[model samples]
Target chain A: MAHDTIIAALKAKFAELVTTEFRDNFRVVVAPARLFDVLQSLKDEHGFNMLFELTAADYLKYPKATDRFGVVYGLLNMATGVRIFVKTWLNEPDLTLPSAFPLWKGADWLEREVYDMYGILFDGHPDLRRILMPEAFTSFPLRKDYPLRGRGERHNFAVITRAES
Target chain B: MPLEALPTLPEGPEKDYLWTLNFGPQHPATHTTLRLILTLDGETVVTAVPDIGFLHSGFEKLGEDLDFNQYVTIVDRMNYISPIMNEIAWHHTVEKLMGIELTPRCKYIRTILGELARISDHLLCAGAQALDLGAFTAFLYGFQQREVIYDIYETISGQRFHPSYTRVGGLLFDVTDQFIRKVRNFVKEFPKTHADMCRLLNRNRIFLERTQGIGVLSKELAIDLSCTGPLARSSGVVRDLRKDEPYLAYPDFQTAFKVVCAAEGDCYARYIVRMEEMIESLKIIDAAIENLPAGAVNVDVESKAVFPAQTSVYRSIESMIQHFELVMPNRQWTPPVDEVYGAIESPNGELGFYIVSDGTGVAYRARTRPPSYIHFAVFPYLIEGHQISDVVAVLGSLNIIAAELDR
Candidate 1:
């Protein structure tokens, strides 16, 4: 089957669930609330059995950005080799999305990573502890609000002094 | 306080008991500072808790600060051993998101270089695995070939480990015929060296006894944990990103290779899979070189997708402004604000780039789905019933590099 036909079938199947469609590359952006069910349906009915990736986005510079944070999921069909992108937008104040760990076991670490960097909460994740950062890390460094140099020269000097002591 | 006078409780029978031991966070066999606190019943392991994050560098956060062009260097640092593959995977992903297709020549060059990286990675893993199993001679032999491959990499990228050779739109520069000739020579000689290494370890009774049925991961467990690259392939999983989803010159090349798997799904299977993969990678490099195309290495200067050259910026004020705006740390180059998850078959399984572009010059979120991280998650499970000595052997066979895992 052609890539376009597969996408067309998906659009037809989940037309009601999706808010916007980026048809050129088979990406469908659904509302955050409906993302979990949509993903479950895609996996059970549509055969996108492999949850390839689950990552987050910080949209600090977009004009039509309804929410400042967006979470993206990539699913793949092992048999057919077709990839589908599912996206859901999250409001800046509370960056939380429904967890997909129950559906795909691989989402365990991926969700933890999203939580670690973007400070997004994966509701219902069994062990959603920080995967890549120190336990005492105070801030989500991936957030746009966090400066690259971090609290500036004073923080660096303080850290150096503390280390020496 | 004499023990004989103080307490004399009558004992009917003395029992021989097993003791538990913890290895790692500093053990040489854990490979990459992974702390595996193990509860051992004497030599056999009862339970293992793999505590990671000893090498986390917060690569995801670093991506937010660096521009699209500079971010390739960051990805290059993820899997330091196979830096070229990481950089190329990220490059292809960014190019896909921006909808900029490179010239055929660039695609061929990437294919060749990626194959070379695969060979180097497999050699390192194979050698390291042998070393962990007490086959020191095999390790030296593997490193001998790896050193030659590194020299080839240095000639192309000018960096020993982290080359950052792959650019967002294309390669850093074009490869000369001399480099191609050297690669061809390496291809011809690599098979004999590989055969010698295999003879040194493959059928050795000691190596087989140590690895054959150790750390067995069934096909179902492998799939559940989402193991990629050699780990998944060894368990009879037919999922190669290059073969399944062709991105660069992989589709153009015509090559035949088997996905090596063992029904046993043990540490031995993983070792065989990697050793066989090195041979297959050599085949791919040969095919890519034979069918190498001739054209401009990068897209034209007028292409709006890639950042324009400095000469174009100097000649045209509009170009200068666009370049400056695109490269600015604060101002991001918008590229449709969509998200793309591009994966390539790296030497260590599926190295995927889950890029969330908010239509900005800087990636909103660049998440690397490294295979090593997933393999590490299942490490404790694999080592549960194994002995303390076999823990090092099992960990070495998994080939978990801390940089990629913690990144």
Candidate 2:
């Protein structure tokens, strides 16, 4: 009941900028620039208080579309107990999107993680450093283009052994 | 009070104004490779920054190479404390992506095993919390009960830890009467030792003094940080996935269990919530066992989603061919081109899997939203104003498992 209302509201508010799908729950595809506005409205107006999850998917070789990357945000309306997904598409060359930290505090680390794994820059993130990967590591291992066995980074670690101390 | 508003003390004789202290990349209180950089003025902590990622094994990258069932072994290593919960959550995500609903018998069995995992997880947390606070007796009592749970796990899955017993459509094997009896016996005999352990630490004056107001996470901050499981509930968040978004057999036994909450939002409150949750898990386990469903545990064999039974594979040529077809990649089953998120109310918190299937045998993306990662993120915020001595108390209450955190 509440999900339909929220879905309808999201569709109405983001009219041309967003398209909606309902699989197990509402899934909205929004333009990358308009993601901040759409998510702001969802948080302020639609009562989706918690930004439960944020993840990225690489569709580089999939038969889907022109976009190579998709960033997903799982929003939950605690009052309604319904989860809705907001996704924004990004392609190569310049993959940057607005951060959701201003809307939810949980987005702070989630955005950092997205930046870490997918190398997608967030415009206004306070501290957009790598959260999971080491600081000296250059490659984003989660990217589809990245090899699973890695490019010798794992084996390149310098052995630091105690000698005569 | 705001962090900036905290009173700054002047430098004293033969002492610096402020200095950095590293708690660990290896320390007893950390229990794992969690390095906390703390700025200390005398004994008071000015700021604390947690540096993680010492255990990142590139599990998500590995998931891209392995198919759904093969990835189960990897998930088992993520939340190694209660590995079975990870198995259930991983397969639950894959099944959701593939649009498969498990049988009633399978759901009930999964629910029972899940609660057993929760009991073991909470018992370990409670025990370790007390041990960190210098009460060794409580830890021993708690591990004794955990061993009982491990016995039940061994009976069902042939292993104590990292069982990898759950399958996409069902479990690896049906619940034997021996497994049921072992579980029943564990549930029947655990409460007395649990009560004794609780009495040993719950009301102890030293514990209360050390933890009552130390590292308090306010309700607003808890929700903002996406803290779940007992951590959020202890802060009076009143949100539990098992209750709010019922999965497995949680819906059937909805009224049989209680979601415990404590408004204190301190180490003591988290201890109370975890202690009560173990009792609640026992109740759910009792109800599930009493009303255990009958019929086949695995889904229809004709579906070919899982391996054919061993007897059938040995008897019939057709069954052997079916097994080979299922195992071989050339004739591997194709999943749909869609994405689905499956989450379960794990012992520590909400463990979710966001799976993307691009009409392939392997998942295009398998993202695990480990609760430990999110819960640990809020740690530096919670520990800023606490004394140096209270650091272990706060860290223990948070239950930051490095395997889950790094994965």
Candidate 3:
């Protein structure tokens, strides 16, 4: 099937679910709350079986943006080669979204990664532990509030004393 | 239900049971700083738990602090061996979002560089796999070829490893005729050298015994796991981001390549797929070089987002401002408040960037979906029934680069 036809059918079927559409590339941004239902429909009914990639973004710089955090999911149809982008928005206080692990097993680590960096909680994630950050890590490094230079340096007394003494 | 009521095995006559062994965070075979706690019953693995993230550097967060152009440097470090593909992918994504298209010349140059990076990556995989299987000569041969490619890279972009040559609108500068001539010469001789390496190791009895019929991954499992690149191709899945999703100069080039696969989906199949892919990449590089065109390398070099040339900065006031804006940290180059997922075909597999721009000088969030991380996740399951020595063989065959996996 043509990519346009697939997009048109998706818009017709889930008109209420899609919040915004980037018409140039046929990418539709959907609300985070309704992502699971729409993703399941796309997988089972629409044949968008492959979970190509799952990624996230922070929206702290945009004034009046709907959500402070955005999670993007790239889905692909292996047989037809059609790709679609599914997005979900989250506020700073509660960076949580529905988990797609039950639908696509590939989401297991990808979700944990989002949690580790963006501090977004994927509700119902099986192993919702830090995949990249150490367990002792206190702050989410990907957040806009985190300093770019990183944590302030601790005093290197051993080296300093060797030079002085 | 009482605990004291449970039956216990007799002391001396009881058979010794399975044991659990933690194999990483420092193990040589786990590749990066991955920790695998393995439960073993005699020589067979009962369950394998992979603990990762010892090498995570919070690259995503750093992306949030840098502008679009500066972010390119960070993307280059994601998969250090194959940095060009990541740079191109990020550039394409940003170009798509900004609605800018490159000229024919720029596209072809990007394709040639991408293919070169692919060759270098495949050489690392092939050489390292051979070394794991006790073939030292093959590793040296592969490294020698890679050294030549690295020299070619240095000639083009000063830097050997993290080149940062690709920008949002186009490349840093056009490839000189001399550089093109050098590339042409390299392509002419690469095939014979590659053939020699293949003959030396491909059919060797020891190499075959170690890799053949080991680490089998089925098509369904591969898809379920969302495997990409050669790993997915080796499992009989015909998918390539370049062919399926045309980007850069790939759409214009006429090249012959196959998505090599094997029904066995074992370690040997993966090895053969990469070996064959090196030849295909060489063909792509040849096509790109032969069809090189003449034009400006960058479309908007004077734009506010790009770094201005030194001559322009000295002569023109606008160029000076543009130069200052580019050089000053955290001053210019803010992205829009939208999110985009940029992906490209890296040698290991799919290297993707999930960028969230908050309409600030820095990105709000940047995440890299590295294929090596996913491949590493499935490693323990692949090595379940195999001997201890086969662990290194399987790890090498997977080509799980620590930088990308841990990042």
The lDDT leader among the candidates is 2
Rank order (by TM-score, best first) = 2, 3, 1
Off by over 4 Å in 2: A20-22, A159-165, B1-16
| TM-score value, chain A, candidate 3 | 0.83
How accurately is candidate 3 docked according to DockQ?
0.42
Candidate 3 per-residue C-alpha lDDT over B1-407 given as tens digits, one digit per residue, 9 for 90 to 100: 12222223234534457666667778656655777666666777656667777777766666766777788898888888788888888787777655677878899888898898998888888888888778888878888888888877888899888889987677887788778887998898888778988999888999999999888888887887788989888888888888877788887654556556667788999989998888888888888788788887777664555667679889999888877876777566665556666677889888776665555555556667789988887686688888767778888888988778977
Top candidate by TM-score: 2
CA-based DockQ, model 1:
0.32
- Tens-digit lDDT track of model 1 for B1-407: 11221222333454234443556678767776787666666678777766677888778778866777798888888888888999888888888788888899899888888988888888888888889889898888888888888888888878877888877677777888877888988998899889999999989999999999998888777776777778877877877777777779888654645556566778999899888888877877888888788887878756655567668888999888767766676664567776666778888888887776766787777778888888888787788878888988889888899989998
Better of 1 and 2 by lDDT: 2
Tell me, what's the RMSD of every candidate? Answer: 6.1, 3.2, 4.6
Regions more than 4 Å wrong, model 3: A1-15, A23-33, A92-96, A149-165, B1-16, B300-305, B325-337
The DockQ figures for the candidates are: 0.32, 0.53, 0.42
- What TM-score does structure 2 among the candidates reach? 0.95
All candidates: TM-score: 0.88, 0.95, 0.89
